[model samples]
Target: MIGGGAAAGTIVASADPSLPDRSAAELLVDLQNAKVDGLSGTIVQSADLGLPKIAGLTADSGGADLVNLVAGSNTARVWYAGEDKARLALMGTLGETDVIRNGDDVWFWQSKAKTATHLTLPADAEGKKPAALPTGVPSTPQDAAEQALDAIDPTTEVSTTGAAKVAGRDAYELVLSPRASESLIGQVRLAIDAEKKIPLRVDVYGKNAVNPAIRVAFQQISFDTPDAQQFTFNPPPGTKVNESTAGKLEAELDKEHKAAESSKPAPAGAEQPTVIGEGWASVVTAKLPKASGDEAKQLDGVIDMLPKVSGSWGSGHLFSGSLFSVLVTDDGRVFAGAVAPETLYKAAAK
Candidate 1:
């Protein structure tokens, strides 16, 4: 996983050649040869984005595709054809473009906000493909599927549960567990189309407050061919685009982050709290809970300043610092968990 959204899910590679009625290599050629009039799929996702980047710690809901790849759409396009740009999430909420490039550079460009930040891409960037593009298009099902699939370790365990229908399509039920990483999904049961050879639904599990409490399920799919026009966008005039390289903005954000952290009071009887004049995102992660005595007390008070949260069910707890999350139960008990605690703090703090 990359960003804070990174996690390990059990990866299951089908040994059965998904050929309609040909050799496996021919199947690859046929699958590649087949043309999708339009590709549309519904997405219900629960992510643990981690914070100080703050917004990363909240649960998010939305759907998009090539049809609405610009302006009002929560869509992004990357050159998955190769490593060009690994993935792009172009929601303008933060007034910036979130670009994950080649799994090594993460740059954010916000015009009106005049803020640009960069992060090092995850180690997995090397073998990855882009997640989206200017127009809604598929580099290949193999590429797209692998992008999601590679996130899971193939060596993890798997089991078949039963059968079900997804988006009105018949599907096989199965559960998967990551043998090593329990980050993204604790366990997942997928609804797959044994015929079309595509996933009908993806259920992700986690316990972090910002992530889904039990699991997130996506239904309502329309792989109906999408119009070709959905893949690109026209940038409006007068929109200034600010961008940061892999590490440019961190220095500035870190400065402010450190300053606010220093202003906090220290533990009782201790010298004043350590004052970091100019702080960055790292400072928020450092000053969070786990402080002793006065430090912890001050941190708790600071946490109380956050907006109170709850689900339709009564459950939520914003941990000290910028940990975004809510309770998971209809009765409200389980915490959704942190999406991106340190990232969230810095974002909310701003």
Candidate 2:
């Protein structure tokens, strides 16, 4: 769900689009049972995380299109036909980046860099591992909706936002709000198609915010199966191609994990991530890799940009954003969550 093309403005839902009455519980069930075999659409994703601008840090800089996803807007065209065939083209001002998966063959292409990466999946791996796409860039509303739905539990309060419209289709809006006051997330609103029961838009709001801090939605869509040719990829002349198999990548990851484990001391969970809380207020704490020389200097410079804070848990630089907070401690540990700074401080103390 991660490849897309160009940047597009946000799509506003139609006002007061009337539909048959539906309860929150019924919609939840519909979302849970929803299924789509084939579809193609243009997706618009935007984020306004309220992060301070830093020099030389932009989405388009050095082909860092993923970075732009957190602070700006982007547009992508996506085509999906069942689980084995899918394509996403991320359009940009300079060029386009695309990820295509067809059966056992997967391709990643960057037009500006004239480079392509190809991976041949094992027959059994075909539909098992998701295509590697930029993290946090929901290629479709369904992707975002699935993530939001995962947070549903006793810690969440679910309700209906009534009728709405997305991508010119009538939809029902469902809202999920965190019960914990410390949770920075205000609510996650999902617009599900009335006829199809599939999500067409997702909006995430910060605590007490009127507008969404992040939005991912389809601007145009079709339920018909996309052309089979959409998933085919052939690199142009002079393009640098690197190839590997899924089995080789898995072996490399296993080797790295074993090496790391062997190099660590015998203490259990020393290098493992620890969950500090449950549900929306959950904080994840992990040990940062020890840096030296230029890496250490660069890390220090970046940390210096954040505000300094101290408590019984010690001192660190705290980055407070619209929907999340991150505390990078001087002791080479990082704690982060969709929680308040105080919640992070509490987690650090443990």
Candidate 3:
């Protein structure tokens, strides 16, 4: 039930029965426009659901060298040329892979098995999903319409609230309410940039409970084309590869993850984690984890990138004041404390 509005910006509107079509060229250009030649920045993100937050520094050479992407305790190195024919090793997660994306085919080299498996997108797609992130950028006008439909509940309508400035960009704000009383997202509002056709902020509120809100800002955007190599990854030797085609493996992985989560017990002294803001007020006690070399390093990097850190007051002032974070395991576990970060370091320490 996420509803949004468009500010009075340079948005091309159509009333004719014959709506406009978005050519592949337009999409490609949009992709290029959103790309930056070289970018090295930190991204900090969290959900009211209290998933382990993301904190780290990433450096890339436009589309040629992914150079490095360091996320808590894990790092990936990618290199590519042309349309990104290269290698990647996710030390902790997927091991390594050799990927080659020639115009005719996209393949992944499994390090563990020493083989290449081709990729095919779902049947319901126009072109290879654009080699770019779909976030922020709007799809075709029809795509926007589909998005609008998806945003609206069968029992709700979208109402334009007003306008506001987000991330220094002008945006239109809108509210979403259900026509019927029975609905989940009681009230949701969002801001969309009128010029770039991107989302600037999202806020969810409810009278019955705490509401969850997430805001985003963009910077240093470019229309410059990324070297095609950014999409490619290769595996180093002695790595095992598992080929997954038709999404079967993905589905299995998800189910397995759910099962693993259900089987986990509370840490030695903690209770179950809580979901705040939208539903509950005060949650159960938090758990802390053992921190070590890579994990500690990742935590340090992530801490540096914190946009706003909450649940802490240092000498009556705060630096990571805006973002809230809790350490959680891969199975969706959580941990927090007053000296939480320090405790985490000692726990994960070797």
Candidate 4:
């Protein structure tokens, strides 16, 4: 069961008893055609990824981004002005971190570190362009909804579940659930703004949990266009400024991905994952760095700090949250997914 504290963050949904009913087909059409000229909002992100408490192991560690999804709540002020301009100011106890994009330029400013990273997007060739612009931060729900809508297939079942209110806006509930029994995901629910036709909130549930494991929603939103000045930034006088181009970054990532896929030992980077099943309960396995005696001991020390679990598949550490679970085996391998731990064991045994 989810704790009361975390449950409080969920949208307190209530049925619109007096509102007229809308068909699922009509709602889907609105979602596909949804567009907003400009908007700003306060987004609340909360997660309960079933992780154990380890001292010094925080949401901002090596897996900070993923950790934050299940262990803590973060608030950010987001502004969007079309596809080419946007800003996100992440509010935190330390200070604010801001990401801003205007046309081909992007700036990431860390207030506590007093640093600014500037990046420029590569220009398209005469006949070619990148599939999408490098926004450099998570996209708005409306943007993400487009991709999620496109992913509908035989593996998923889509339907509507009445109406809800999110951030004070009336919304229709759209639910997508996997058809396969092996999937860990119970359902993905999206609250679509009835008038705006954009997602106002998203909730993800696991098979074993009644509450959403992950929730991202607007606490407050405005439809009026934000001032153009919001998209511009300048580093303070003594702040450290670094510069790079998007093309170079993309090339480096591609190189790293290929290295991860190779069976040979890889340097420190994200390991490429291989799928072991289909649908929701699929296990994703990734190659781990090969370690010697001393290196293995050092790695174990780090792993020991995380929650420990052992079973027929062998001993290793488990890092889990509500929507996802990761198992790092002793023999240099890692398996993970949004499913239960037993599912991972099956992959490890194989």
- Candidate 2 global CA lDDT score: 0.81
**Please, what is the whole-model Cα lDDT of each candidate in the order they appear?**
0.39, 0.81, 0.37, 0.72
What would you estimate as the lDDT of candidate 1? 0.39
lDDT of 1 by residue, 27-73 (tens): 22233343333335433333332322222122132323322221122
C-alpha lDDT (0 to 100) for residue 113 of candidate 3: 56
Across 1-350, the per-residue lDDT of candidate 2 in tens digits comes to 11122121132323253566677777777887887889999998998888766544432455345666877788889998988998888877568888888988989898889999898987787565346565634467877887887767778877776577788888988888888899999999999999899999999999999999999999999999998988889899989998987777679889999998777556434588889888889999998866567977887887888889999999988887899999999887899999999999988888
All candidates: CA RMSD (Å): 13.3, 6.5, 13.7, 7.2
Residue-wise C-alpha lDDT for candidate 3, range 1-350, written one tens digit per residue: 22233112222322123423232223223322532232211121212322233322232223111212111122233333323233232332333433444443456664545665665544542234323211222122123333433545334445555455654556555454544332233555555544554444555444243644232223222223445656544544654545554366468779999997666653455554543321111122244443567866786555545443223322111121112223433322443332223332232221
TM-score of predicted model 1? Answer: 0.37
Clashing pairs in 4: 47-70, 49-70, 49-321, 49-322, 50-321, 182-281, 183-280, 183-281
Residue 48: error of model 2 in Å? 0.6
Backbone clash pairs for candidate 2 read 4-76, 4-89, 4-90, 4-91, 5-76, 5-89, 5-90, 5-91, 6-91
After aligning candidate 2 to the native by TM-score, how far in Å is the CA of 82 from where it should be? 1.6
Error of 2 at 8 (Å): 34
Worst 10 residues of 1 by lDDT: 275-284
Order of quality (TM-score): 2, 4, 1, 3
Q: How many clashes does the backbone of model 3 have?
A: 37
> Which prediction has the highest lDDT against the true structure?
2
Candidate 3, residue 76: lDDT? 34
